[model samples]
Target chain A: MLTLDRHTYEAIVTHARRDHPDEACGIVAGSVGSDRPQRFVPMANAERSPTFYRFDPREQLALWREMDDRDEEPVVIYHSHTATEAYPSRTDVKYAAEPGAHYVLVSTRDPQEVEFRSYRITEGVVAEEEVQVVSALP
Target chain B: MAIEVRIPTILRPHTGGEKAVEGEGATLDELLADLDVRHPGLRARVVEEKGGTNQLRRFVNVYLDDEDVRFLGGLSTPVADGATVTILPAVAGGAGGVAGG
Candidate 1:
């Protein structure tokens, strides 16, 4: 199971709505080997296409370096699906390099509802996991 | 000191099951070539010769010191000793045709 505080959860949802039509993506950094997300970083979807997203290469580089300096890692990698259920597509499974991170997907297809889900994609395998939204860090 | 290349799990076979390998090159292209010399067929998976030019395959994302080489300078991106270069397959964004709007 994956756990997130309400603030972080809302931040992801807001970013998803802000980038509606175009996919939104970002990373939540956490202490190395901690597996707990503590930092939120909303990234620019380089593709900026309604059906696609890619991190701005330069921005990703800089941010990743910053995380490295802080001894952190991308514990939660997230993206939005505007017209489909929150789930990992085949491509998403194919490119999941961080076996230790949570892959979160938020679907805003329904005007009144948002489908939030998490998964662990490792070696072409996609395993949906439970998400617990907490009021504060435990 | 040599540059460190972190290989993804899928590509571990080429490196004799090693997750990270050492290579030497002034540029990413040269580094891949050097790696190919040792691993023999590893570069083809990460790069391709297209339209009379060598380009990183669409699915491949290579980062030099956490910065993507595509934005830094593509294959011509320079590398210094002790840099940590990572190669990962591109996910979600353009992976396997779009599944949603």
Candidate 2:
């Protein structure tokens, strides 16, 4: 199960809805070896396509360096889908290289209802996990 | 001179869970090849032969110090002593628009 603070959860949903047709991508960085997501870091979608999203390489390098300096890791990797449900697509699964991250998929297909889901993708296998939203991180 | 290469978590398996390693090469390709000599199967995961030529896998990002190798000479990018080579898997992917539910 992935436990996230309500603020972080709301922030991700807002980012997804704000991007709307174009997919939004970001990560929540946490202390190394800590599964808890504490910091929300949104990334530019270099692809900027509704069907595809990629982090800008320059920004990615910066992120990595900063993480290394801070001894942090991306605990939650997230992206939005404009026309599909909140699930990992074939492309998503194929590119999921971070085995330790919780892949979160948000669906902005519905104007009124946004679907938020989390999954663990490792070794080409996708396993959906339960998401628990709380007022504060424990 | 040896080039310092930082390995990401996803590719650490190929490096025996090493976070960083060193290799000698004048070019990025040579560096990776040199590293592969010690850590087998590491290069194959980051680069693949395409159209009879070696090309980086689409989902992988490699940098020579701060500049992305794609902007330079790619795998043939020149690397000198004390350069830091970083490897990271691209964080990407999205829906194909098939499932609307």
DockQ of each: 0.37, 0.60
Candidate with maximal TM-score? 2
Model 2, B39-75: lDDT tens digits are: 9999999899878999988779999999999999999
Count of steric clashes across candidates, in order: 0, 0
For candidate 1, write residues B25-52 as lDDT tens digits: 9999999999999998889989888889
Which tens-of-lDDT digit does each residue in A78-135 have in candidate 1? 9998887888876677667678889999887887897999998887888999999999
Error of 2 at A126 (Å): 0.3
| C-alpha TM-score for every candidate | 0.80, 0.97
- For each of the candidates, the C-alpha root-mean-square deviation to the true structure, in angstroms, is 3.8, 2.8
Q: How many clashing pairs does model 2 include?
A: 0
With candidate 1 superimposed using the best TM-score fit, by how many Å does residue A130's alpha carbon deviate from the native?
Answer: 0.6
Clashing pairs for model 2 are none
Error of 1 at A22 (Å): 1.5
| Candidate 1 residue-wise lDDT at B58 | 71
Per-model lDDT? 0.84, 0.92
